[model samples]
Target: MGSPSDPARHLLDLARSRPPTLGDGRLVCIDGPAGSGKTTLAASLAALAGAPVVHMDDLYDGWDGLPRVTDQLDGLLLPLTEGAAGSYRRYDWVLQEYVEAVTVAPAPLLVLEGVGAGSLAHAARCTVLAWVEAPDALRLQRGLTRDGPQVEQHWRRWMRAEAEHFADQRTRDRADVIVDGTAAAPPRSPGRVT
Candidate 1:
């Protein structure tokens, strides 16, 4: 692969190709701390790959749910590798509980985006794992801005969970691609394939 200045397009190419380094069907994980740009990258890649995405925030039980959500992510995705529809319950943060079970039809490529999406519990099963990281200060500001005043306290708590989870998982060292989330993606027409 050429050194792609646009990290998102590069990742989109990776997803479209389904590189052999990955096992069977695509299980791509975009992981990083909150506001590290995992969501943005995932969206760009998903658009290019014509893939459905699973956001870890929807699976999280709460601010301290980082470690707990990996199992659920694994359960939701593992079935797809064997040609079954993936399903899971979405946890509502405001309600502080799981609300609905979402069904994701099996596809050639599946994207999981958010903090802890690449946790060790299921990283081995992923076809491709991408780590998007940004400066802590910038990430914190992005998070606070996105989440707004309501989540200021929750953001602090999630920050602690992010540190502990990343430390335990050693996610960066193991990633197949390291993306500088701060950089803007160059424009490219999406050639998504089913």
Candidate 2:
């Protein structure tokens, strides 16, 4: 195995030379707990492959809109699997309305990023599934900071739900690649804290 510096190269090589265990169609999913940097990694991978990404954030309808996400993913992102124009209705969080129609054309590789990006619910169509795993304490701190105090209650509830979802779904365990998203400090000494 190689080092973690170039994930896209790693994935591409895996896709190209993989044995018959993995299937075809070039779709990769990067899933994880919130704030695990799935989006950042997916963007990097997409750029490396000269592929486009189908961001799940664009499909979500905020805290109350999750149930509708699967529909959007099916309608918008999945079409790209066949090199079609992907189109879906996006929800406007601020105005609290279903906003505009966004369209994207499929490519050789497509990076799907977000929670449940690799869930069994979505995996039947994915060629590769990658999970970015981070410690819960670290992830919660990052998510809380990003979400801010105004949405403290919302964040807390979402975190609980996410925990439950991961437990039931086993998304990380089923991943083809596991990414470590801890802070960029040297590997901690066995007995040290920081």
Top of the candidates by lDDT: 1
Compute the lDDT for candidate 1: 0.76
Worst 10 residues of 2 by lDDT: 185-194
Q: Cα RMSDs of all predictions?
A: 5.3, 6.1
Candidate number with greatest TM-score: 1
Q: Give the per-residue lDDT digits (tens) of candidate 2, residues 1-194.
A: 23345666666665555432112246788888887778777887888788778777667778755545778877765566555777878777677677899886655666778886766666666666777767777777887788676877776676777677777777766777766666353211121111
CA displacement after TM-score superposition, residue 10 of candidate 2 (Å): 1.7
Which ranges in model 1 have alpha carbons more than 4 Å from their true place?
16-24, 184-194
TM-score for each model: 0.86, 0.80
Q: Taking the tens digit of each residue's C-alpha lDDT, what string does model 1 give over 1-194?
A: 33477666666566566653223467788888888888888888788777888898898888877767867876787777567777888999779999999988777777889888777777556766788878888998998788787788888888887888888888776677877778764323233211
